[model samples]
Target: GRALGEDYEVRAAATAEEGLAAVEADPEAVDLVLLDIRMPGRDGFWLLDRLREGFPNLPVVMVTAYGDTETAIEAMKRGAYDYLVKPFDVAHVRALIEAARKQRALTRSAVSLEPDAPSPGDRIIGNSPAMVEVYKRIGQIAATTLPCLITGETGTGKELVARALVQYGPRAEKPFLVVDCAAIPKDLLESELFGYEEGAFTGARKGGKLGKFELAHGGTLFLDEIAEIPLALQSKLLRVLQDGTFQRVGGTEEIRADVRVIAATCADLEARVAAGAFRADLFYRINVGRIHLPPLRERRGDIPALVRYFVQKHGAAVGRPVTGVSEDLLRALQARPWPGNVRELENEIRRLLASTRGEVLAAEIPPACPGEDAACGELRSLAARALEEGGEGAFHRFVARAEASLIAEALERTGGNVSAAARLLGITRLTLRKKAEEYGIRVPDPDA
Candidate 1:
């Protein structure tokens, strides 16, 4: 306090408890905290936890004798603005304090604007070009009221994207309702959607309940597995789309709803329409603004980012220190064809974190699918061929080389166990064995 002039006010406490008490007594007065790591009663890290829980916006700079990378990373994870080693320059400390203060102020301002605007949530985390484009499209679509149809394979985060759209959209202030069309019983779907008037059905409520459509007024209504919506109900839904009016069962009064419709489906609606099972008109209506989320295998570049995000998220949820994802583990993740997509990746990360005992992630990561290795070999062969040929002929060479490489790799991975390889490749075992013969790929014998 004596060293610094009136421009700064310094408070001294004998113990961590006293310091915490001083801050508790007057939180606003304390702009920055210079915490000593070896404080009595409670260490700086413990104090950091208290600050994080009570006042997350407050910045705490840890003071240590020697620099420790693990400790610094952990402290940063625990909300410490920065750390300062002992014998450090006074100017460095001043700079750190200023930077921390600026960061805190910025965080507070950002939090105040839209606390629930999906600010880098653990569900969708990536900064890759593909992911950036996805985010840009989401933001652009959020401004409009166009109906969106999200088509993706199971576990590709279709619903998460839908929620992002709703949360960031203009109608974010209103209710965002979700209806799992596939989960609801087909017989009761109409009542669930259009509501039944009093005495309209034997078990109808006395006051007549509000249907999901009316409940989602001035907001977004998300229909999951839209292809499951019964054919008969599809016509009623289409009417609601054409004109924002739906009539309650046994009631002549028409109810109008102002809501943005967003639908998701794993099934091919075109196929169902062709089969006369789904209404073509309804399909066309909901498919106005389509967003097809790429499967995880197609976006292998995002695996590392996703792994990091999940490790941090799950580690924090379980009160464990954030762990590092090893290069080998990342390579395994990249090689695997994530048929289940982001949801599958999240589950795998959670499992790894639960079984892991320390800070390294690779040790606990489970064995990867053998198919991944084969796929990687095929990709490498394709790259090699592409490099050998010039750019003009690279595309043709790569395609042929990839096909041959895949057939050879598949046969080799199965140990000439063509039947097993066939199943893995999603083809008949006989077809796989025949292809292996045609490609002249020497399949290894099981005995060898």
Candidate 2:
């Protein structure tokens, strides 16, 4: 304890039983533990296994003179913070303890403050019934290796869901490789994924490059915009999924990857399959489990929590001390439909922090998007009429129809190009498409 620094407080336990007692008595009192693998009566492995069930967060550093690679790997698998070969340097032990403390601090900070609400790290932020269901589904599926297909609008945090699954699941320590199918060039994506040998293609790196599958072995491989992957490559990806075997672009030697595939897309994949733009077989392979992130407008109840999260995150990033958001500003925020979802909200917060000074955030509030403001106004008008008309369903249908018609007309004017229509309507393409589909309106063809 004294060797490290005055900042650390250490307690030594004589026996495994006593150590377990001490830990159970006051879980928060201990920071790092030096557990000997060969202890009297109950061995270190047994103790380690028991401690994991009760205090998984506690950092246990194993100490053994007869340690082997298998023992080290097993300790890690059993959640040992780190292992020390016996007669190890005092400084090394101190360093490992310090690192464990830092990791624990980060984990604690990620939990949300509100006791009743789900913590930020628990799942995606939202309180709607749909969101609650999503969280439940995530918990149920996190333990399995089944492929998950995340479907949502562009800014609806599909990647966030994927990351959360990896972070909170069994393969948390393993690699989490992301392949942006839409961003990478079609010609080079295959090589990037399956890797290439020195002579596989022109300008190939010497030796052989490890593909994403190899890099993400025994972990997750997230394929974002999976629908954008070229049809020819889809067959290759399918073969890997079927046999977990693939050869480098130029090499004939087969390599097996034990990876969990999580694919995501913003496109209507079923429609794309019908159009022959995507492989129907690949779709079925990756769709064993699915999670659809609802667009922000559909779950406006989450706006407050999301806004607070972004404000705090960006405020710290920009070195500003931000006070709580104003009630009027929050009302305005909740009133506006966030087309870009969590991502757009984060960007807006960064912009606010960059432009404004002082603790109060009202001064940094940007003008509401024109479409959102208009929608809010119409809702208010409808609400007033509904109050007067004794809450008639006809009025509700009328408002819904009007909103749908307005969106459909805007999409039509843009020639069914969802992105262009989103730009024209001052909304996100994800939000626009969702609204269009909800209203049963035909999405215009870009060619037309």
- The lDDT values for all models are 0.71, 0.72
Error of 1 at 432 (Å): 30
Predicted model with the maximum lDDT: 2
Cα lDDT tens digits for candidate 2, 1-448: 4665565666777678888998999987777678999877888888898787777656788889986999999998887777889778887676566556544443344335342333344235655545644554565456678899999866778887888777657898999999987556678999889999887888888886989999999999999988767777889999999889998898899999999999998667776664445678899999998999887778887777777777765566667577667777677777666655666666676787777667766753666645565356445433443343343465655465456546755655665677877898899877876776554454645467
Q: After superposition, how far is residue 19 of candidate 2 from its true place, in Å?
A: 35
Candidate with the greatest TM-score versus the true structure: 2
In model 2, where is the ten-residue run with the lowest total lDDT?
Answer: 114-123
* Residue 7 lDDT in candidate 2: 57
Give the clashing residue pairs of candidate 1, or none: none
* TM-score of candidate 1 to 2 decimals: 0.56
**Clash pairs for candidate 2:** 416-444
